[model samples]
Target: MIAGRVRGVLRPLSVVSIAIVLVLLIYGLLGYSVTAVVDGVLAGSVTSPSAAEQTLRWTVPLLLMGLGIAVAFKAGYFNVGAQGQMYVGAMASLVVGLWGDGRAPVLVIPLAFVAAVLAGAVWSLAAGLLRLLLGADEVVTSLMLNFVAVLLLQWSTSGPLKSRAGTGQAATSESIDAGYRISTSTGVSVPIFVICAAAVAVTAILVNWTRTGLEISLVGRNPVMARWQGINSTGVGLVVFGFSGGCAGLAGAVEAFGPAGSLRAGFSPQVGFMAVVVALVGGLGALGVLLAALFFGALRAASLYLPVVTNLPQSGIDLLSGVIALLITATGIPLLRRRRRRRRAPTAGGTSEVADRPVARRREVVAR
Candidate 1:
């Protein structure tokens, strides 16, 4: 039993170690000093209070989006349109904030947040509806929607919402009112902290403590089996998709009100994709995503700082993320899937372990 627990702990650690080793080898082969790369990472991530703040700033959005993606994955749905969802959410927030310019910040801010969440949910559910109703592939529909969202952002910023005060070529919307801003440019503030804390609490409770959570795990592991046991697989799918999109939308709101203070075309282009990687690396769990987001946030900070300290390009950090993603795909995800299958399968004693509950509890659920 002790050995089994140790192996379980080491499984994730081994994947991380291998990814790091591979990154070091790649950098070494490219003629960059591995030590300098390591130093640059530390300096960018945790060298000082300012550095830590920067890391936290990136971590906030990543955590939100990662949690959203993790939830969808838990229900066996692949909602890859976080980028589009975030864009629509940002656009919704921008429109609301701009429309309510003369209103009180307290009222306007909450309205903008609601608008953002609703917009994101609708955008995401569009794809889910297509998948469920029309038998469309969600991965394709969701990914294609990303391009549509980018085009929408481009047109809106360049046409309807364009800021006239900007002389630069980059298209951008007018800045949000100062009162509505939750954080400064650094993206770290009390309001931001409160929001993240609330999200973590709510998500943990939803995923770990609710009957819905058990349904999600069961559906993910084996949808047919879940259906056989009278679970509403379609409802579970929609719930997860909506929840995931809402989370992504909230992240966009956080970005706009906390750090960005405005909507810019093509803003934070990689954050959505990076968040997918974060979810996979995190083992699709709340606690794991929190830790993984911090890890990637440090990498994000380091990527920016590496240009200042070494000859390496910023894409080097992306390469590291890509490598880690590959490793997780090959090892972590498959391992988890297999283990889940094992738990659901019957043992030699003719008793099933099930996913979140024992076989007896599963029988009770089926009977109901």
Candidate 2:
């Protein structure tokens, strides 16, 4: 049993490790200093206190989104709209923060957080509803919503929420009160850390110890079988959608109250997209996601540190993220084959073993 569990864990970690090496080698081939790249990546993450703090800050959003991605993907929903959900969530929090100006932090902060989470969930529910109710493809709906979210973000910053007396460099919203700030602009704080920890704990419990999680896994593995077993596949999809969006929205709230005190036109640009990579790299497991989030978060901090420490362009780290995604997807072939094999298994009675099992059991038909 122990060996089985260990092997299961190793398979995913190996993929992530291989992907990193491939990315590094590719960058080196392109004329970048592999050593400098490694050093620059580590400089802020482990070698410097301030940079380490930045890594922690980045980890918060990535971890939150990674957890959500794990759950959604496990339920077979390709929620590519996490970016949009995060944006809408941030927008909701910003609106609440602005309107609650002068309100007690104790009250306004909680309210804004709820608004952010709900806004994100509502946004994601659109794709879920489209896919489940109208028989539309979730991939298309979620992907398209990303562009809409970006436009909405632009409109929010430049239109009603624009800060008066803002400089020419970038448009932004008015700052919230200091007391309402959960963390400083540098994005590190005890409360923020506590919030992140709580998120992980909650997700772990949900995925590892609950019937909903088991049902999600069952539905993901085989929807027809799950339905035959009396599992509500549609209900599972909707729940995963809401929960996933809520997690993304929570990440947005963290950004607003923790690192960013106001809504900037564009901030942490790649977090949502990178989070998908983090989930894949982490093997879509809670513990794996925590580790993956820290790795990616450190890389993000390293990206910021690289330009300052070396002559490498700021885009270098972004390349690493992109390459990791490309390679991880390449590793999906074996799993695909396994799934296909499972689909083709046959019982001695010559029935389709995979599909007929649950459907047969449902009708009290025993397999010989």
Model 2 clashes, total count: 0
List, residue by residue over 1-368, the lDDT tens digit for candidate 2. Answer: 68966875787677767867887888788898888878888886879769888888889899998898888887777787898899899989988888899999989999999999999999899998887666566779988998899888888788798888688467787888788999888888899888888888988888889999899888677766776799876788899999889999999988888788888866777888888878877777788899989988998888888898877887877777777777766774355334334332333343445666567787775543
TM-score, cand. 2:
0.88
Task: List candidate 1 segments past 4 Å from native.
Answer: 1-9, 332-368
User: How much lDDT does each candidate structure score?
Assistant: 0.84, 0.82
Kindly report which residue stretches of model 2 are placed more than 4 angstroms away from their true locations once superposed.
1-4, 333-368
In model 1, the clashing pairs are: none
* Worst window of 10 by summed lDDT in candidate 2: 339-348
Q: Please, what are the lDDT tens digits per residue for candidate 1 over residues 1-368?
A: 68965664466667878989999999999899999989888998899448898899999999998898989877777788999999999899989999998899989999999999888888899988776555566778888988999999999988889898977698988888898899999999999989888888888889989999999888887765886799876788788889888989999899888899988899888888888878877777788788889999988888888888888899998888888878777875664456345333333343343533666787898999
